[model samples]
Target: MQTRMIDKQWSEKYPGVGKGPVATEPCISPEYFERERELIFRRHWLNVGRVDEIPTAGKYFVRELEVCKVSVLVVRGNDDQVRAFHNVCPHRGNTLVLNERGTCPGRFGCGFHSWAFTPEGKLAFVPDEENFFDLDKSQYGLSAINCEVWEGFIFINLAPMPKQSLREFLGGVATQLDNSPFSEMKLLKTYKVEENANWKTGLDAQNELYHLPFQHRYTIGDSFLLKDGKYCRFSNVNLYNYHSVWSCEYNPAHKPLPTEALLNRMDSALTNIRFDKRISDFDWYLIFPNMALLLFTGPSGDFFMTYNFWPLSVDRCLWEMRYHFPPAENVGQRLAQEWTIGQLRDTLMEDAFQHEKIQKGLASRACSHMVMQDEEITIRHFHEVLECEMAKV
Candidate 1:
């Protein structure tokens, strides 16, 4: 058994931690997971992509969200405003924008009937214009979903009428990270993997730092837990509305692996790169249902990455990791960032490979409840939020 940190127990120190013996049914049950699809995923504000992906007029991309069983087409109009609509053609319901992303010029046309809709989602043309009666052009236009942008990130709500604006939903998260360089930073690269585990199961693994030293022992263990003889405690965990932020102690003196050490030692200039001027090396933010904003401060450019967990089924989810970095000024800078990326990839692969085994274990119904420690407060809070949202209907 791991040594439990009693003094740093957030569940007791903080009043909000939810009551739970975290259940396995929520991980493996199809019926209850369906309730999650209807009650939670559809109603929540879900992050889809960043504005940088579509910077010019008439640029658009189709995002297929399996959780809601709806494909969303996000567009940048001639007016330069970003918007989203159902990807289905308004007439025959044939899918629109077959390509993952492309420039629409002025509008997109369905391949089946050649019905074209403007970037602003207005019905522009149809080949057989004289066939139908009472065909109001305005009525036949593409249907729009509630779309909003925050800090250059695009979020789409499938709710017929969103309960609150994205600003209202994000609350203090906006104020806290308002100054982040999200608008200016560029996408360095993206890594994607499909996990055969419930979305929650995958997300739960990342909400805290307790597992870093053990699960990631070979790759990142020494960095988080130095030869120091003391247990490393998270600096603090702050909860807001339904979202939460957790910061952990970072050892500035933490040594790098042999390859990285050799690279940095060879080029002293690489040490000059700093991910951010933040106090902690890591600040992880969980946005309710499915978004994780993992901000970092490292020896390379100050940038933040995002983890998007898109559910495909009760026991399957598509997981994506996006890496954002400031443009590299020199070869040294690029190599430094690549070094970190390699380590992160290896670490995430470890976590990803284990998720399937966890799913299989949960399927066994080997245990009714999984006991959680004080360090796992965020996981408990996540389950609490899911239970609360699911109970609404």
Candidate 2:
């Protein structure tokens, strides 16, 4: 199929404000990936893990987004605050945390030189106390990054000084979800998958609903209205500097039977809950440079779920999906909601399979660029944001 160019009329109508040109070469270039690691991933506020993941003092989790060669340590301090530190030891630059996650016995000991650090990244001990003369323990502590938690998810920025705070980075997108039940939602399960594709390729596949009808037909195809879906409801797509939001309600014209039934059960189980089942919506918050946060509200108004993405490399990425439920819901209702997670999992597998094929295709010389349509405004906007950032580098 021939790739469709952005509508000239749309560009003329919005003139100077429409989507930018599509990037075909950069998407498949290894050289571009190297620059991306330096210009984008290293400087952005990357999502590490959730605050709930390390709930107790001394608890810690390591996030290895190796593309940028970044290994971050998310630790819960004695003061009950969560902090992120570079997982490298000061001496010989050995990795401080070897395991994915575990509880630190009051301090983290580097296996290399037995250097110990408090959960707050403060140096506490040295193996040979008298071995090194004039070695200042205070100056050799684990280096820390700017860390913050927003609505339960922990975020870290590697920049010595970030240009924008997490709150400022989130902007109005955070306010739109301020009334959401995310803060109270407990983490039920986490599913991680590594896709063999550029992080942008995986993100491009997710930023739009245009592919749902064609790509996920056997699964969620019937659940969403594709061509018939309205463009400006629930929340409108807003493109900021490097971030974008593609917000809309599920089209009422094509709500599937199973989805409708799920919505009814949701209402019956929750009190004082009212959702316009016909117009149930979700928002896809794309934190550019790299990251996609999918926020969904069930048709029954009983729960919310988020899919957080972290780019592992130029051609690899990791996704962490968490389901959230109300604190008041009974075990039976929560369990029923949990079952929905299975359906989501199936849909994700479907997406992953297609993304891998696209990656292979992009690697081939036969095909060059992909097409875009009005419904794919989200994906188009993403490329625009990426190109803008690349130009600055």
Query: Number of the top candidate by lDDT?
Result: 1
lDDT of 2 at 120: 89
After superposing candidate 1, which stretches have Cα over 4 Å from the reference?
1-6, 225-232, 265-279
Write model 2 residue lDDT over 181-203, tens digit each, in one string: 55556667677788887777777
> For every model shown, what is its TM-score relative to the native structure?
0.93, 0.86
How many residue pairs clash (N, CA or C atoms closer than 3 angstroms) in each of the candidate models, in the order given? 2, 0
TM-score of 2: 0.86
Cα RMSD for candidate 1?
Answer: 3.1
Error of 1 at 190 (Å): 1.0
For all candidates in order, the CA lDDT equals 0.82, 0.70
Per-residue CA lDDT of candidate 1, range 61-159, in tens? 889999888999999999999999999888988888889999996778899988889999999998888998868888888889889999899999999
Taking all chains together, the TM-score of candidate 1 against the true structure is: 0.93
